[model samples]
Target: MKILLTAINSKYIHSNLAVRYLKAFTKDLDCECTIKEFSINDRIEKIFEKIIEEKPNVVAFSCYIWNIEYVVKLSNLIKILDEKIEILYGGPEVSYDGEKFLSQNPGEYLIVEEGEETFRDFIEWKLGIGNLKINNIKGLYYKNEKEISFDGERKPMDLNKTVFPYEKDDELHNKIVYYESSRGCPFKCKYCLSSTTHGVRFMDVSRVKKELQFFIDKGVKLIKFVDRTFNCNHRFSMDIWKFLIDAKTDATFHFEISADILTDEEINLLNTAPKGRIQLEVGVQTTNNEILKNIDRNIKFEDIKEKVLRLEKNRNIKQHLDLIGGLPGETFDMFKKSFNDVYSIAPEEVQLGFLKLLKGSSMRFETEKWGMVYSPYAPYEILSTDSISYDEILKLKRTEEVVDKYYNSQKFGNILKYFMPKFESPFDFFFKLGTYFKNKGYLDRNISSADYYRIFMDFTEEILNENTEILSEIIKYDYLKFNKKKWLPTFLNRVVEKDIHKKIRTELKKENIEDVHVERFDIDILKYEICGEIVKDTKYVIFDENNEDNIKYFE
Candidate 1:
């Protein structure tokens, strides 16, 4: 028997780890298992053709909001090509709205939460076992033309019981990295997908170490941890982290963590981790207390702030902070403050996202009351309503584009923070830039930092002209042209400049500066000294140059 697992990822970098987990579960089943991947950028019909070409007996599709539409379309094409090939779908996107979804989308079975064991049993039953029954399975919503049935909830596997005994398949390693530390989440964030998979469970520490060893032995460079809150269980999180720290493993592990829950001990352990060895993604959805309360996310803003700041000081862990724009009671101004506040923490990456009113989430139930009108399609992204205008939400989406380009992917933390406060709200600031690109026919759907910065600076100059303070603080921008004299005078006037300069000098000291050179620029009686290299004849003279007499000091 042959089984094929696949998904349509947003990018090769964004492939789903679910495929990996499924492969691990079915390795011992003795069925020939094959995995394939499709991306949104690929032509859908071609993907269908490829799947048909492989012609596996069973095709299991890993579904998500980003790729469900493509999956459904592909599934329909599969039915057209050959109805005999069994089709199955699973993942968070289809976990809810199962009955309706099953009715509309025929010829597919749904695997509910924690699919490893249940999917295996179902495959076995189909292989030739008579009197097959799905009701015994804990986590499945199976359907036939005559009836739709809900299987009893499947309990999560003992993490120790899960293993990837199959030979390492490096063929898919570059496209995706499979992962899972535990099942379910401990927090009840109203907007989250994992809330439905609550009650955090952990893998036996020894088994986790073994898995890490396997990936290392295979020379896999990237292993993404699918744990919703990696550090939620404290001791388990600590043990795995410490093991990785001690092993000094070459493979990189990416985790999504709730920063507020990080204890001092964990922070200390993380500090010892080698740079680029670990990447943490923290969700700082909003700073507004009222909004947080309304959404039932019980995290304290102050605690989150403190933990993030401490973690950042380590200089080892690469941090990514996340914020959602359309939440209950969060206006454009409130979101702006959230952006500026989170940006100030100086995470290596900051993601600006629009809210998705996922089916079965608490937000879905509250949307009508909260005045949310989301897209009626697969992902169901929130549009806007009385609480927030559609126009405003559109602006936030544009802002998200700019943020992804400049802040998140580009790694421009310093420059972005320096210019953050100029516009009343981050949405306004970035959306205006987003609009300029769209208007000029210059917007690259997949824009790069080089593409974005060029347009951003064009608009930024006008905004900076009105607020010189914003420009003055941007010490890194070359085009701003703040010579030492221009910058020093402004720096001296500020009350905090001394402390700021001290920090700069302290950091520079770590680099062990070999020398310092000062150059004086004098042209037609205008004379100035700038603290940097002097290579051109700009009526300038190096302080130690024999021609220093030619340049007079500026009065």
Candidate 2:
């Protein structure tokens, strides 16, 4: 028998650890097992053709909320091509509704919950290894005569017994490899699936260290920990972090952590690590205490803020702070306050996301009680609630776009810092900018970086009554720092005499600078103090291609 464990990821950069794990665990089975991955952007016909070409007797799909609909359509098409092909579906999306999903979609088996042991047993039965009947397999749902029947819930597998999925796959070296030190979450946040499971089961620290060494040896770019709350067990998290830090690989590890739970020692440890070596995604869903209580999140806003600020002080770790727009008892004004509060901390990235009422989450069951109305589809995003209307949600959507483009992009940080105090709050500034884009019909259009700068200049001058020339010069300075190719917008450009270029070039050459270009702008370079002090009238901004850090001014 031949088996193919596959998944359709949302993007090509993502490698599905689920399918890889299934294949690794079933390696002992007497069959030709392979892992095939595709992106959702691929044509269904092409995917079906590839599967048919493989001609596997068994095909198991790792489903998720993002790819469930696409999987269903593709699976149905596959069944039409070959009815004899035994199709199977598993993953969080179908784990709760396995019966209903199997009944409607094209699949004969649905493995629910921890699939390592269950999949191994099912594959053994398919390969006829022993008298192990299908009914004996726990965590499996199959058709018995006319009705779908399931074996009882399966116990979580011992992580020590599971094989590392990346042991054999060479292609994963350049992709974002996901690693987990533990299973299940300690907290019961109402909106998360992790709340349904109890107790955290950690993989052996020795095993985790070995895997980290393997990934480090491979020189993978990123290893994102899939653990719900990576810092729930402080010792386990620290042990892993220490191992990675000691190894000192160029690989960057990403983790989703609770800020309030971080210890001073852990913060210091992170502080000493190399810059950009580690990234933390801290989810500050909302700053409203009432809403936090309603959701059963055991975190004080002040405490989280202090911890986040402490981490920021280190300046080594890249912090990605998150805020969910729609939550229970959160009005527009309250959300604006939440936004302003999170934005004040100055995280590297502020991800303003909406609440998704996922299946099997406590929030989904209490939608009516909380006056929440959501889309009845995969990734069930909240449309409105008693405190916030649909129109307000629409406005927040636009505000989210503006935040992503401006503040989150890190392009207008200095400009925003200078002008944010002009408004009542950061939220007010973003909201007004979002409205400006909507009025100008630029909200839904594709905008270049130059166009974004121009739009921001217009907003500052026409609406906020700020000096556009000063803002333009600051933007030009910022733009030139990242982009080596010397090009300035018309508003920012100033004519430089040939003699001035020659004089600056000579000075740069004396300083052992290479690939230096001189540009003139109508702004006091001394006033725009970036890194070093500018002590004289700066008519020209000298840009060095080889060294981005070598930006200087010459009169």
Candidate 3:
């Protein structure tokens, strides 16, 4: 019999680690097995054609919230094309409500919780190995003659027994490879599905080190750890960090960590690592203590703040901080305070997200009790609550857009740092900027990078009444840093005599500056400030070819 394990990923850059794991576990089963992956962006007809071309007897789909609806429709289409094709579905979206999913969809099997052992048993039974009975397989739900039956819960697999999913497949080379040093989460934050599972099981440190070396040897660009809290065990995490430092590959490892749980030793290790070697995603959902308590989140906001501030001091490690807009008992004002608090830390990126009431999460059950109303779709994002109305949420959504475009993009860092202090709070600055964009219809229209620069200039001149020349110079510097070409915005293009460049280069030669390109501008050399210190603009911006760190201006 032929078997196919497939997944519809959210993006092309993502590879389905689940399907790979299933195929790896059932590799020795006396059946021909293959793995196929497609993105949701792919046309359904094309996916249908590809699957039909495979002509497998058993087709197992690894489902998730993002791709469940598509999988259901595709399964129905496949059944129509060939009723003999056995259909199976499993993942967090269908694992909780297996019976309902089977009743509504065309799938014949649902593997719950840990699927490695259960899938192996089911495949063996289908291939008629050793008179194996499907009913005895734990963590499996199957439909037989229109009757849905389930086995008991399956025990979690020992990580040591599981083989590494990557098997020298050339397709995985350029994708964002996801690695798991550990399974399950230690903390039970109510909104997360990981909270439902108890205890954390780690793979053997030697196994993890081998896997890290494999990816590094492959020259993979990024390897994101799927561990819920990567730093939950400091020893395990630090060992991996040390291994990466020793390996010295160009690959960057990304981790989701709890800031409050980080030790000083771990901080020092991260601080000394090579720049861009590691990136951290710290979720500071909300700063409201009452909401944090209601959600059973054990984070101390003050401790998190202190730890994050220390992490920010490490120029090598890039940190991305997160804040959720909607949560229990959080009003708009309270959320603004939360936003302002997280914004003060100055992470490399600030991800403004809304609360998603996911399936099987404790927070989903408490929606009614907390007076929360959310969308009843796959993602189940919150629409409103008793404290925060829908209109307030909409306003926050606009503020989120501004934060993503301006603050998180890192393109406007200098100007934002300069202008944000003028407002009552950072939230006030972003909220007003969001409002300005909405009023000018820029929010609804398509905008280019150059247009964004022009819009920022207009905002500074008309709304904030700040010095446009200084703002333009800051933006020009930012543009040069990000963009490769020497294109300037129309407003910033000023005619300068050739003698000005000659004079600046002559002055720079005395300072031992060589191999530099000089451009003259219209701004006053002596009056402007760069990075909070008065510096001569000289109308001459010097770019040294060898040194990116040395961007000099001469009067």
Candidate 4:
């Protein structure tokens, strides 16, 4: 019988590690199992039609919060088309609500938590290759004549026994390949699903190194560690990181780490990594200790700040920091302070995510105590809490949008630096900017990056009443430095010395002025950008993003 293992990812770039692991773990069963991957952004009907075309005898879905709804809809459609085709549900989403999920959905079996061995055994039994029937297998919940029957929880697999998920890199090209050298999380952060599973298990360090080497040898573009807290075990983590650093692999390895717990040795080792070889994602959800305490996150803001700033000083690694909006003890004002607190570090990306009361997470059970109202859907995003209103949450959502467009884009870096000082706080600036965009209907639809620049100009000059002349020149400098086109924005003062452009082009042995980009700005934008020093005088600047020595300033 043909078995199809499927995954519906939240995005095109994300490959589901669970499905890969399950397939690899059970590969010895010798079933004709195939894997299908699609994005949640894909239409459900289209996905349904594609699955029907596969014409498999068994269909198994790897489910998660982001794609559960789509899986449910697709599974229903598949059942309608062919009831003879057996269905199976696995992954964290269905694992937590196994009985409930099986009762409501078109699935005969729910492979509960830690699915490797469970799935292996089930496939063997279903194919009559193994005598151990479905009921006796731990971690298997099956339909007993319209009633869901469950066996006890299965032991977490010896991670070493877990086979390397990929034999070849053909399908994973350009996708973010996920690797799990370890499973489970040590900390009990109430809002997170990891808190549901206790303790951490790791594969053999040598084995992990060998697997990672496989990715490096295959020239994987990016590998993200699915380890909840990558550095929970010092020696194990250090060994792997050292291997990655010394191997000098071109792949970029991303990790979510607890910055507060980092030691000097760890910091120093991380500092030595080749630039772009390592990237960190730190979860500083809030600076409010009460909120952190409520979530059982034992971290001091000061400690995290000190540790993160030390990493920042290195300037070798790209850091992405996180901030959550709605929490039990954090009010709107508290979140404002939290936003500003995280903003002070100015990491490469600031993810302002709202609280999601995931099904199995502890915080989901205590929503009433916190007066938290959330969506009753798959994602279950917090609508509001006693501390924050829905309207305020909506505003923060808009603010998040503007932050992604401007702050995260890194294109408006120079312009933001110039304008931020006039504002009260970074939070104040972004919130107002978000509101402004909302008021102008800019956030409602797609707008080009050039349009964003023009809108920013309007906000700076018209609303802030700042000197348009200085702002325009700064924007022009930024635009030229970041953009390729020789043309300047129409709103900006494009008046340049024709003689200087021609002289510079000739000096570079170019036949036309457009062949080489050299602009004379009214102010030394680069000097001002590098430091607070305002030259307030004309200077010529070259623009080429690809060149190592692109932004050369000439007097």
Candidate 5:
């Protein structure tokens, strides 16, 4: 029998492990299985065309918020094309609503929990044996006309029974590396799906070492751990960390961790981790005690600070901190405090995210109590309600972009740090910039980075020109460009000669008369957004006679 299993990922870097598990189980079981992968932006009809072309005997889909709608629509179309093909659905999305979903749709099967052994049995029964009974398969939710039935529960599979991420396929070896050191999460955060995965289960240390050796031998460049809280079990986490350190693998491993649970021993172990080998992403959600309590996130503010400082002080690890905007009782001012506290640590990246209320999470069950209003769509991303207005959420969304470009991208933090003391805090400064960007109609606008940089510089000029004292704090610079050299920040301090012609001549080592050229500006063409008028001295595109295409324009 031929089986096709796939997951629609939000991005190619986030491919699913479900397909890998299925491939491992079916390899030696005398079954032919293939996987078709696509990103979220890929068209559904195109995938259906491919499926029709393949004409597989059985089609199984891995469902999640990012790809459920597309999968469901395609599955229905496949049924219409050929009613005989067996359809199966599994993943976190269908794990909760499998019964309802299967009952509503006539000819679909739902596999709950881990699907390796059960799916293997299903394939063997269908392909080899005739008229075989299948009611005994564990963790399967089968639906009749009006009722849904479930088989006996299945125990979690031992990680030792599985293959490493890159062991199954050659394409997956060097192109991508995604593995999990542990399963389940200890904390019961309301908005997360990890809580539903139950208690933590760590893969054997020796097995993980073997996998790391394979990855190193293959020269994989990137490895991402899907573990919910990598630092939860101190011994398990530390043992892996020490092994990776001793192994001295060349690949970079990224781990999501709880900052407050970090121990002194773990800190020492992390210190031994080679520079650029590990990157840590700490989810700090919110600093407000009331909001944290409402969401059942057990973290103390002081401990968060202390732990973050310890991690940040180590130059070996790159730190990424995150904050969610639309949580219960988290006011704008309260969020500002959260931002300020996190900004004080100065992480390499600071991500401002909006809350997502997944279907199976505790937050979805208590949305009414929290006054949460979310989009009635497959993803169900939260929009603001009574506690947080839609307008405030919109502002937060823009704030997230500015944070991405300026803070997270590490482009403007050096300059923005100077304004931290002048404004109330870093959050206040970025919030005001977000409002400015929105007011200028650039929030959702599709503008190039070069154009946006010019526009931002124009705004900064106006703000600084209003108060020259700000100049004492922040550096004023312009990008220098040429055929041999590209645009690079040239500090104002570098140009002691005030005259433009003299400065150009001195910098380029050319005569003033030869370096200078007379240029004309169509006075009516310089559109300035802040002043709402045209400037007679300059035009939209300033070009040099030597290089006609070399020009920059701003709002």
Candidate 6:
């Protein structure tokens, strides 16, 4: 039998580890199994054509919220075109409500949670072609002419025995590959599907090292651990970290860690890691006490702040912080506080996302209790709650784009630093800036890189009276540091004595300084950089352009 295990991924750079695991587990079976992956961005008709070209007897799709709608439509078309082709569905989207989904979709069977064992057993016994036997194949809902029935749930497997899923390392180059050293999670954050399961299971440290070595050898650019909380077990996490630190491969390893619980040993070990070796994504969903309780996410804001700050001091590992906008108890005002709290940490990246009331999660069942309304479809993102209005959420949605372009993009770091203190709080500054962007229709269309500076300047003139030129100076310094462009933007081009560059170039050469690219500003950029206080003086900023750390100031 020819079986095709398909994956509709969210992006071209993302590889679906689930489909790979399915293929790996059933490797020894009699069936000729092939794995086919496509992006959700692909046209539905095109994907259908590709799937039909495979000419498989059985087609199984690894479903998820991002691509379930497309999968269901494709399944219907496949069944309509050729009834002889058998279809199977599995993954988080269908595992929770197999009965309702089975009644609606065209799939002949549904493989519930932890499908590696269940799918193998189904193939061994019988597929839809032969006998429709719904015997003791654990974690499956089989459909017959009479009705659809589900077998019992499957038990979780030992992490040590799970085979390495990625047989094709050549496909992972320059892509964001996913790896899992563990399964299940310790925390019961109600919003997450992980809360449905209990206990954490980890793979053996030695085995994990060997698998990582495989990726390093293959030149995989990134490997993001899918473990719910990578740092839950200090010993296991530390062993993995130590191996990576000692091996010192060029590939970057990323982990989603619970920062508040980080031990001093973990912090010290991570500190010693070579730059670009490790990146951490810390979820600080919110700092609001009421909202945290409502979601059953137990974390102290102070402890998170302390640990993140300690890690930031080392400057080796890059941290990306997350904040959710529309949690149950987080009103617009309350979310502002949460935003400011995370902003105080000064992470390298800030990801502002809305709460997703996913299926199989405890929070999804309690939506009525909280007066929450979400889209009646896959990826049920919260629209409004009793505490927050839909209009307020819309504003927050617009604000997210502004943050991505300005703050998260890291292009306006110095510009934000010079102007953020002028407002009440970080949230207020961003809120007002987003409002300006919305009013001017700048958000409606794509703004060029230079136009972004001009838009911000116009917004500043509307709000503040003076200090526009100083803002331009800050932007000029930021832009020069960004790229190797010799010409400045029209608005940013400043007047200076014609011989200034020659004199500065001669001075740098005389002092044995390698960088000759320099610019003079009327204000004391060096003193203002140290303390926020602006000191007036004729200052020359020697720009290395290539290295930010090499930037120096001359009086």
lDDT of each candidate versus the true structure: 0.71, 0.84, 0.84, 0.86, 0.73, 0.86
Question: What's the count of clashing pairs in each model shown?
Answer: 4, 0, 2, 0, 0, 0
Worst 10 residues of 2 by lDDT: 529-538
The CA lDDT at 223 in model 1 is: 78
Could you tell me how far off, in angstroms, the CA of residue 313 lies in candidate 4 after the best superposition? 0.8
Which digits, one per residue and each the tens of the lDDT, describe model 3 over residues 78-133?
99989999898888888888888887788789998878899899888987889789
Give lDDT for model 6. Answer: 0.86
Which stretches in model 1 have alpha-carbon errors above 4 Å? Answer: 129-138, 172-176, 410-432, 444-453, 460-555
Task: Write candidate 4's Cα lDDT for 380-443 as tens digits.
Answer: 9999999999999999999999898788887788888877888999989999999999999988
What lDDT score goes with residue 317 in model 2? 90
Q: What would you estimate as the lDDT of candidate 1?
A: 0.71
For each candidate in turn, the TM-score is 0.80, 0.95, 0.93, 0.96, 0.82, 0.92
Candidate 6: regions farther than 4 A off: 126-134, 494-520, 536-542, 545-549, 553-555
Instruction: State how far residue 216 of model 1 sits from its true place (Å).
Output: 2.5
The model with the greater TM-score, 2 or 5, is 2
**Tens digit of lDDT per residue, candidate 5, span 443-463?**
767876455445545566665
Alpha-carbon RMSD, each predicted model: 9.0, 2.3, 2.7, 2.0, 8.3, 2.7
lDDT of 5 at 480: 24
Q: What is the C-alpha lDDT profile of model 1 across 68-116, one tens digit per residue?
A: 8888888888888888887888888877776667768845578876677
Which is better, 2 or 5, measured by lDDT?
2
Error of 3 at 261 (Å): 1.4
Clashing pairs in 4: none
What's the lDDT for residue 129 in model 5? 56
Model 6: colliding residue pairs: none
Error of 3 at 399 (Å): 1.5
